[model samples]
Target: MITLLLSSHAQRIWGERIAVAVPPGTLSFLTAEEALAAEGPSAADIAFMTREVTGKSSPSHPTPELRGFDAVVEKSPNLKWLQIHPAGAERPIYRQLRARGVKVTTASGATAVTVAHSTLGAVIAINRRFPLLADAQRRHAWEPRLAERSPRDLAGQCAVIVGMGPIGRNIASLLGMLGMRTIGVRRTAEPVEPCERVVAYEQLHEVLPQADWLILCCPASPVTRGIANAAAFAAMPEGAHLINVARGEIAVEQDVIAVLQSGKLAGAYLDVFEREPLDAASPLWDLPNVLVSPHTASHSLGQNEAIFGIFLDNLARFRAGQALRNDVDNLG
Candidate 1:
């Protein structure tokens, strides 16, 4: 028998489907809490967990004394695979899992459509000054000049998208429909359909000045941490917008704040922050030109359903001894 552990919430959402799909007596379900509390040894063969269940900064349950996914993995002696619901797996966590000889998979493409839609919405909101208009409405001030508040159109604009992954490609396609040209940047200058042209990392600076919008959709890696720094801001044209739907550590917060304060960039739509829950006193919260979301760009009504589908399909692959989809490269 193969024991599959899931969070109480995940079990509620996908339990029935999983039970129906897997052969009888071949699988058993255990809530994350139950699995973590198990004594001595664990019968679990696979674990499906989200960052929340893994505990971002601490263990999920105080009694069990597990201090994050690493602790959970340490206890589950029979665990062979881990499926993370999020697209980007934290480097440290990935390393720990790999060291234990456990394979990790991510739900990378599952949230692509929702995240891409959010990116497109942010681009339009920044260009059209939607926040400013909303503020005007809140104050009950009918300012006629609001229409002239530097609102720009998407048509004929140039967008430079960093990272040519599934989310990036979807954003490019949506922007293309608005008549915007997209230039994709990746490690290799491979041909991506939604992009007008794809360039390597070395050419990022060369194309920055021509972009009306710059979007970051890359995963967080050693090479990507703080990739967008002061020099990158200086290379962009004044009044250009930035949208970050990728990991927060990819851009330096202080540099972004400085550029936004100096009006070097018109605005920024940030869905993630270097430090999550974004310090209560952070100036980015008060910036008129900035739109901040609490790292919910990938959230949608269908998110759970979509992620469950990915996990379900991967379960079949695991049973058949086939390679899992969206397997983490585990470079560390």
Candidate 2:
């Protein structure tokens, strides 16, 4: 039997589905707490976790009751594979897992559609001056200035999508449906569909001035960390909207604030922040031109099921000794 250690949140969300996917007596499901307490030979063979499970706190129990994922990994000697719900894995944890020769997989494309939809929504909200209208509504006042400003339309507008991954491609396709021109950027300039043009990372500056909207959908890596800084902001055309559905570390917060302050950017929609639970004292909360979403862009009614489906497919592949989908390439 394949012993799988599942996070309590996963169990709560997709326990029935998981049980049905893996036939009776073929796989044993153990909560993280249970796996940590298991004896040598009874330890888990696979760990299915979310970002919460990898955190400093335990998702199943209080911190005092259970140690974090590192401890779980150390205790579960039989663990052979790990499936993380998030697209990117923490470098340290990934390195340790790699050293142990454990195969790792990620839920990369599972939330693409949701995240892409959120990005397009943000673009439209900013262009249509939703923030101004929302502020006016709070005071029970009718605002004609919103209309006087001549809200921009998506038609004929240009959008630069950084990363060109599944999320970026989905965003490009959605934007294209609205008559917006989509240009994609990646490490290589390899052409991708739905994007009118795809350019290399080195050409980002060349295309920045042409974009009415700049959407960040890149993965967070050492090379990409803080790629959006003062120089990048300065290269963009004035009043261009910024949408970040990717990691907050991809953009420098201080630079973003500076650009907003100088009116270089018309507005920004940020779903993620450099520091999560974004400090209440941070100026971003008070910025009139910025919309903050507490990193919930990927949330939707069926998000859990979509992610679990990836796991189910991989489980089938595992049983058949086939290569898993969305396998993580170890970063050297």
Candidate 3:
């Protein structure tokens, strides 16, 4: 019997569906609280984790809790694999499992469509000044067009996407169809279609100054943490737009805010934050040149169902003892 530990209530529902889809796999459901209460380190062959399972209460960055993270790894002595619900996995819990010789995986490709749409929406919302219009429309006021910040077209713009992974590639394709010049940044300079040129990670600095729209789509790994700092923001043209749909920690929050405040960059569209529920007093809430979303770029009514579809497909691979998809071999 393969004992699978499910920590979130929502995950339990998804897991039940996956369990039924898999071949004769047994599951054990427990909340994060209950899982902690159980004594003697409950053993499991596999563990499915939500952000809650890793001690992160917010939708932003993962909480820094080595103890709780270590506790989870310690709880599953016989664990073979640990799967996270979200795409980014630079969390302490993921690292802990890596130290424990367990395999890790993420729902990386699953949320691409939702994330791509949201990121594109952010770009449009900020460029079109939707926030101001939304407030005015709420009051039943139909004001004439506001003065443009800079009459720019998303098409004919030079766009640099910082990752060539599933989500990044999807965004590149979307932008390409809109007649934008696409440049890709990948670990290797592989030939990714829909991109005019592929640059290596080392060439990020070179490409930044040329981008009219800079989109961050890289994975949240150790090497990528805080990769986009003041230098990156400063490298853009004066009125260039910035969009981040990747991990929040990938960019330094203070630097981004400082640049936005100083008008160095025309505007920023962010769906993820270094900290979530963004403090009630966060200046970003009122920043006119920025669009702040509650890390909800990857959420939709059918998200769970879509995730289950991928999970069920992988479960079939597991049953056949074949390689699984989106498997994260290294947590760090």
- Highest lDDT against the true fold, candidate: 1
lDDT of 2 by residue, 1-332 (tens): 98888777777877788788876988877787665566554377987776455443322222432354556766777888888777666446766886788888888898999998898888888888888789889989887754558777789999999988789999999999999999998988889998989998888999998988889998887767888889998889888888988888889999998988888999999988787767799888878768999778888877766777788888889888988888776322
Candidate 1, 161: how far from true, in Å?
0.7
Of 1 and 2, the candidate ranking higher by TM-score: 1
For candidate 1, the per-residue lDDT at 289 reads: 62
Better of 1 and 3 by lDDT: 1
Least accurate 10 contiguous residues by lDDT in model 2: 57-66
Candidate 2 collision pairs: none
Q: Write the per-residue lDDT of candidate 1 for residues 186-257, one digit (tens) a residue.
A: 888888987999998778898998888889999887777887889988988888888899988889999999
Check candidate 3 and list the clashing pairs.
none
Best by TM-score: 1
lDDT accuracy of residue 97 in candidate 1: 75
lDDT of 1 at 262: 89
For model 3, what is the C-alpha lDDT against the true structure? 0.74
lDDT score for residue 217 of model 1: 95
